[model samples]
Target chain A: MAAARKKETFWSEPISKVDLQRPAVVPSGTSIIDAVKEMKYNQIGCVLVVGADQKIIGLLSNGDLMHEYVGSTLPGDTPVDTIMTENPFTATPALTVQEALEIFHSNPFRHMPILNGEAIEGILSIRGLMVFISEHLPLEVMNLPPDSSLIATHAAGE
Target chain B: MEGLKEYLTRQDFVSSSEVRWCPGCGDYAVLNSVQNVLPQLGLPKEKFVFVSGIGCSSRFPYYLDTYGFHSIHGRAPTIATGVKVANPELSVWVVTGDGDGLSIGGNHLVHALRRNLDMNIILLNNRIYGLTKGQYSPTSRKGQITKTSPYGVLEEPLDPLRIALASEATFVGRAVDTDPKHITEVLVAGAEHKGTAFVEILQSCVIFNKNAWTEVSDRSCREDRLLYLEQGKPLIFGEKRNKGIILKGTKPVVVTIGEQGIKKKDLVVHDRHREDPVYAAMLTKMDYPDYPLPVGIFHAMEKPVYEVELVKQIKEVTALKGRRNLQGLLRGSEYWTVSNKGKTIKRSTGISSLANDESKVMDERIHALLKSTDPLTASLKNTIGKIFYDYDYKRSKMLSPRDSIASAIALFKAAKIECILVGDAKRLYGILSERDIIQNVVLTSVDRDRMPISSIMRPVYEIMDESNSIGDVINILSISGHRHVPIRLKDGGFGLVTIRQILRFIHDTVEQVEKKESEDK
Candidate 1:
């Protein structure tokens, strides 16, 4: 008899499997304008405000800036810490992508800072996880073209 | 005016938040195309506002840096209307999906389009509910099966472009997500239009309803399946550009240009600006297999913008009324003032008036009736034994410690009581109340079906003596939050005293006092 196959789960995959990019990091006292410039240059959604020890103190996103200071009287040179979310949720490299996805879904955030014992590792993004999952999906689904024959008229449920 | 400020680029419109749509979703292309086209419209970034209802396509506002409103489900059009009416200078854009617009906000969409407001409305038609996860939408084809419609949808799909034309939209167009260049051009044209411009973009969900527009969007076959409509040109399509649509007695027929001797002039000429919508409506009905789907502007005409007209009317009325104050307008002609003595004074400036004496009489009578029903407190000095015996203690359910929580709950429901006594009458074990069941059994992971009552019941060995005053029971109940407490009867029988008994005593006392007062009067 053939050995029973072990079922694989999509969410339980390790975070390392995701194509994480180096996170954009700004000093705690960095101006909002400069921090935004770094974010724009890096082509990332957010930047991690780190203390002198290189530990994440807060995280700032485009949404935070737009809501708090975009059209407000606050000057462009204001410290980014004033608008950053203090003690943002962080996950370690050992965490599963499912746990990261849950954090992203529950909160209005699109990016999360990955850590390795107080050391900044990389940023795990929802888009990155989606790309990883898409690559792992069956080619028939990932590369599906608009074809009438592939359309299912009835649900697979019996 | 154009050279004063630097021209905005596509990057200026791109938001910092990550575009979280699924990979290969057609929304990404649409977002990119809009971001690219908005810079060319010569409007400041702050002047544009994107309003969206709830759905996957509604996330368009978040991906843009412009001032946007993520409104409630199926209400994007109403919110957009309000935004535009409040500030006609702002360029408002309403983004909605098939489910959000056609299914729930259908009335708002039709009316908004019919009014011909100076704004842009983009309907991302994927023909499926993507955000709620795989449900058939109002635009889902008949006989198409989805999570909600297991046997297949029985309703005919709604054509958004046809609806736009029916609503008398000033500008109506269609685009496909796969063709980003075309979407950009159509969006720019819609944005520049003076009145309401409704564009229906056929996109793919990639997850729930993947490849929904494959026939018209697939790159390998799109050219042969789609006819790009241009003004003054014949409706010609197909890979070789030989196939053309010719009107045959109000019906469109696909004919070969050379083989059938059907010259270009013999085909139907695309004239989108025609005053009548019959030609545009015909273009909207063309579909795959029999006819190539039309993909450009189906109709465009000049109309009086609703917002501009509304502002003009408001200004005219203000001038005619000579700027009347709100107070004077509200108190126009006459109004009444009710005094503390219940007398309603009728007053009118240079007009007739009559007093409403009947209302005053009814008010005074209601006040007098309310004053007679003041609450009378019960005597707390009454002995616990007196109240316990009157409570009909025999009705209190008694169960064994081995009884399941389910049985205890059943007994509580059957007896219409909040608590049940555990153990025999002679030997008291504990008291099990609904609060205990909810707090410990129901809310916890413990199984109510198999778990014994003893697991959640409160052990109550300190029984109140019958000779104790009612005030002492009240004190104990208030301090411990206990709904029911055991009592040792004077006759050496076990009984239960509940908080409901005290409330009943108070109510009866108040009723007796009221009766006596009435009789004396």
Candidate 2:
């Protein structure tokens, strides 16, 4: 079984990939109520605020909505720019699940957006990563692999 | 301490928030111990403040009637620092769990101890993340399993008492949750200490992580496990006080009081106020099963608190140099004259200037992403875009190409889409569109350098996912200001679902309902 596993490399399997396309963005001036409505209609948990030339300026998460909009004394019509966490942590598509998990753990937020150049491709959540890990790796291998081993291997050659 | 009885009450110390911990949680015992000790301190309840980070034990502030703040995880120390600095008269107490304090908040806790901040920090070492449903905490013993650590933890566990002693906390102590009297006494002593007093409480997480410290808290605790330290008393424990710790060279050896010709003077005498931390750290390292676990104050010393010293320095500096106003400081900087002032220019003109300047364009893209409908997308784009655009191209040799690619993908995922426009600091690269997924290697045929997005004219931008809530989609769109988005499945597969499709669906559903209502009418 060990010899067979060694021969059948896990990396050789075609790992599923997320699309790396640019996503729609919202501007900072958008009202919290309008942003919340947009999120509700779009069925998403967060909105990214960008400037006119399509540079990401800040992030507004569901937590922000819960804390700043629903939980705050401010009117629902308050501008999203006021409560958004400016310059949020970001990651790229090529980042491994392990690297992503570390960032998520160390940082405050549960959800991090994937960036490609000037555009956003997708949002990665801790839950999503966990699901990915459970589906891809066996339960025994979950804690067996050191966190360092899970880091993205970029150096050339074995 | 004589008139302490009339000064405070349990009701005066309780806060308005309803306690939400599970029944029989160790937190209840610790809470009761704290309340029982508060009246003994001869201070008004209003003069006390509780700052707690996120955790089950961090809920201490909620149960306390005093002024308190339920701060973010691992930030109670910072908050406590501010509270102590603001009102030196007020007694500040920081309540944190093992996970909150020793794990995530270790940095803050160590610094707070090192600075000897005038406060009492109670680290409830429950060895699990009780609030988050029993994940392995920093103080969890090696080879312990939990929800997150389904297999035993491979990393070495942190010893809170040793860490405190190492950090030079003026007052360092350890107590157990089961011993209410001892816990209360230690709390009172910690409160009385003028400088930073750090105490570690070994509490059990009974529900999710049960029986973690069973060996230590078992019925044979007195006879077999505990090593209670008292000032000027010999290091002794056991039912008959027969066992005593004696120094053999540098290491401690357990010896009977009246056996092996070991004299009473040979036994180590407790000196908690010793300035040197070596002995205190050694005492803290004593663990159960192998060695008798040391409890009670290990180290207590006097040091100028960070808050007190900061306040004094601030006062002296302020008195010497007059406080400067914000407006004066802002206006003092060199000002530039512009040809056009207060006149709004066309959006096209703004873009033209931005296009000419690469840095300016990069800044604009960052701003656009930040203001996008999706906050996560905007945040991700902004963070990565700024790093890419602002990084010195001359020093680009140091850049990790893999990280760059990963960052780009992360940005795209954060945007909640499949299509992304890859760009260098100077200009846009090939558009990684959804249709480019020709047998998986996306954009495999397209030349990354030569292919401008104008060549790919099939409206390649696709809706990423439909399951995403309207709030999330809007947040992304608002942040990035893009018309289309790409959605994905739970399994990480691609599916295009746009904001326009959602709007259209809602419009159609509403129209259908309205028509039905009119027919019924």
Candidate 3:
């Protein structure tokens, strides 16, 4: 339990230091073909549309694609705005990692838009944090400490 | 002598709630000592209310015949303050522990003492949260190994008496429950004293933190290891009665009287009335094996009490201004507009937006939000993060099957829940629900309080996972009629979801559709 442990404010780290790997961006009228192709190439989970002033007006994650577009009656070139969650929760580059994490953890939606006063700065995906953790802590078995006497035993030598 | 017959008896203070602490717990002695003193105080039984926070000791209210409120963990003082303020005639006694008083309730305890509220705070210092089975409490000594602190607790334990003294508590005392006579003396003084009388009772938890007070509690060594303080009397203790405490500047030194020319006159005499708190602080700070632990009143002085002063202030304020009745107060320049039918009427608050129809619709949105169901179910994937409800197991009122059916009823009634898990911290053996009780209990002639929950427990049917769709949940609920269902935790533990949440989804979907159609019209 890290109740007593001091948590690092990872969000305070500059946006430049954050992984800015381009989350696929497409225009409103872009066909699903282009969005899918971009996702396949970049191996990213979602796409966002930036309006004229580079403001994020809408988003389309894989959840929207699978839950609605895949099996339903929507046309491929239908505008992304028609399907995206309106007035979605967002964050700013200046947000503390604690605040960002709270937003990420609190919501069912995973992808969050990082803004610079309504202008899209970038997008921070929950996967980015996971990747950051996995990189620091590799997926290898953590060996126990070498004190062999620490193992559970009977009160007597037997 | 003439008023002897008017004095209330101990039997009158006994309540019907069974005293459920473990056998041999020091709490039994302390409870008897308190009940013994209450009658002697000459206050009517109705004048006394024992308020306690969560701990083994917090159950004091249930066993008492007097009116009591069993408050939440560490916040008994807050409720007691409300009770005292509302009715200044009542005598409030707070029963808290090291965990409840120092750890979580520390903030409330500090303010209550500092304000010098008219109440008696009897802190049971067992140095552990015994109810939670054995976890290192805030007062647990450093390097004390416990369930939570397996490697050993690293934080230094708190000294509650010292804190009480530091918090400007008007009267502070200490007693070891092992010494029954001494406990009675301390509790009597605690009840008589006005303002906050903080008494720390050093008690033993036989199961955990056992023998913590052995030096002063054990019969063989207690005489030498504990010093009972008396005003104007030189402190003396030990098997031979030859040992005495002498002051070396501010520090107290244990000296064997008549050894090396040490005389009883040279020893420190307790001055309970000393205005300064330094003497009390020093007495409370003394540790065992160095200086004998000081018991009995450490400090006793008077200050203007919070309740008395508040009442006086209210009276003074009313005299200074005019007394307005409820109707006049409500009608004080506030405006309201009402129309029965199609006619438009305007009575201005002048801020007018509140009267606007659009704002009314926005208010409806807030209502919808309040009644808004969770958009998603507790599925195989993580949905919402944990909340107060998710920690129900930790907060749930649990009982062993062998525990009295009365305890189960009390717990269920207090929590206002449909069921309670029957077991200990280790595992849930089964759950007892209202359905089980109704189907099995009231129909039969079983004695309600004596009946065991085991006879009526319904085993948990099954565990649900996040992968279960809302439809799957609906089907399960329809077939089994289980109101509450356990779900797999995202972090490998377990969580719970209730049918209420599923029903909320259906309600929210209907409301959303209704809103859409309304907007279109």
Best by TM-score: 1
Q: Taking the tens digit of each residue's C-alpha lDDT, what string does model 3 give over B1-521? A: 33642667888787777889888899998998887787888777778888888999999999989888889999998889888889888989899999999988999999889988888999999888899999989788889888999999999888998889889999999998888889989888877788989999999898898876876788888888889888778888888889988889998888998889999898888899999998888888887888888899989998999999998997996887645466754554435455788344444443332225554555555444323133222121122223213434453356888897767766655565555667665555677765455334323446767878887787777655554444444444444546556554455444455543433343344346558769999
Misplaced by over 4 Å in model 2 are: A1-158, B1-4, B15-18, B334-521
- TM-scores for all candidates: the values are 0.50, 0.49, 0.49
Global local distance difference test of model 3: 0.70
- Where does candidate 3 stray beyond 4 Å? A1-158, B1-7, B324-521
- Which residues of candidate 1, in runs, are more than 4 Å off? A1-158, B4-6, B331-521
Query: Each model's number of backbone clashes?
Result: 0, 135, 4
- What's the residue-level lDDT of A141 in candidate 3? 8
- Candidate 1 lDDT over B291-320, as tens digits, reads 899998999999999988998898897887
Worst 10 residues of 2 chain B by lDDT: B393-402
iRMSD values, candidates in order:
34.8, 24.0, 28.0
The sequence of per-residue lDDT tens digits that candidate 1 reaches over residues A1-158 is 21322322555788977888788999999987788778767867688999988889999976566456543577767898999999998888888865665565456566788888987778986556545543443221234223313323212100
Stretch of 10 with least lDDT, candidate 1 chain B: B369-378
* TM-score comparison, 1 vs 2, better candidate: 1
